[model samples]
Target: MLLTVSGPPGSGKSTAAAALATALDYEHVSGGDVFRELAEERGMSLGEFNALAEEDDTIDRDLDRRLREISETRDEVVLESRLSGWMAAEHADLRIWLDAPLDVRAERIAAREEKPVEQAREETVTRAESEALRYREYYGIEIDDLSIYDAVLNTARWGPAETTELLVALAESYDPQTDEGTFPVSGVRYEF
Candidate 1:
């Protein structure tokens, strides 16, 4: 079973995905880690790489392609990324979207990154705008759409531990035999 955890920054995607993988004894693959490595390889900061990626489609397309391949080849893995749900598409057994209000997410991001809340908030807004445009332009995906996700959780309501427990239970009780189908990938335009 391939589980894809997708959410915006500060939405507990990495924390929950790691915990879920440990509890379920599955491999955890993070697209953020991959992206960060790509940034490091280019001798750029994450923000710098994000800016570069906006101008160079290959950056995101290449990263997304690797993730898509991982999804296609792997089972019993937890894949985490903002686009993992959409990238995995039909290969994903359970696609979960985690979210929180922008303010709450901004605070979380600030605390995690050891930055001022105001700066984090501003960056959050800017990054979201950039991503929304890129997602729409590059893949024909509406970043706001939750229709493709099997479950959408508000990570702000519970702490990371509780969120992981919730996902654990969801994975444990999952019975594909009696399950309704997930939404199909539609209206996507893959550049590669």
Candidate 2:
């Protein structure tokens, strides 16, 4: 069973994915970390890496192929990425969308990157815009769409462990044969 977790930056997608994967004895794959490592190896910034991705279809295709192959072999796998839902497609047994408020995300990113809140907020907005545009231009995908997901979760009200537990429960209760599913939100339901 492949579980694909996606969300905007600092939304706790990676944290929840790791914890859920560990609890379920699944292999965890983080696309953002992979891209960051690639960027470092190439001595380029994330913006430059994203520009390269826009120009190079091979990079995205290769990663998608590798992820699909992994899904084929692994019984339990947790795929954490902004575009994993689109890339993994049929390979993912359940697609999860994790979200948090903009202010909360900005704070998280600032703390994680050791940057000022103002700078982190600017960078987050820039990166999110670049990612959204790049993904659409390169793969014709909109990362914010939730219709493709089995469960949509908000992490602003819950920590990593609690969010992971909720995801695991949802995964266990999911019936691939049925269209019914559960979406965990803090207060309101988003149409997308």
Kindly list the per-residue Cα lDDT of model 1 for residues 120-175, writing each as its tens digit. 99998888889889999999999899889878899888898888888887777665
Candidate 1, pairs of clashing residues: none
Taking the tens digit of each residue's C-alpha lDDT, what string does model 2 give over 1-192? 788988999999999999989988988999888888888999998778777877787777666677667666776789988888877886787888999988999999999988899888888898888778877876788877788876787899888878887888877766555633444532233332
- What is candidate 1's CA lDDT for residue 39? 94
Local distance difference test values of all predictions, in order: 0.88, 0.80
TM-score of 1: 0.91
| Candidate number with greatest TM-score | 1
Which residue pairs of candidate 2 clash? 1-75
lDDT of 2 at 34: 84
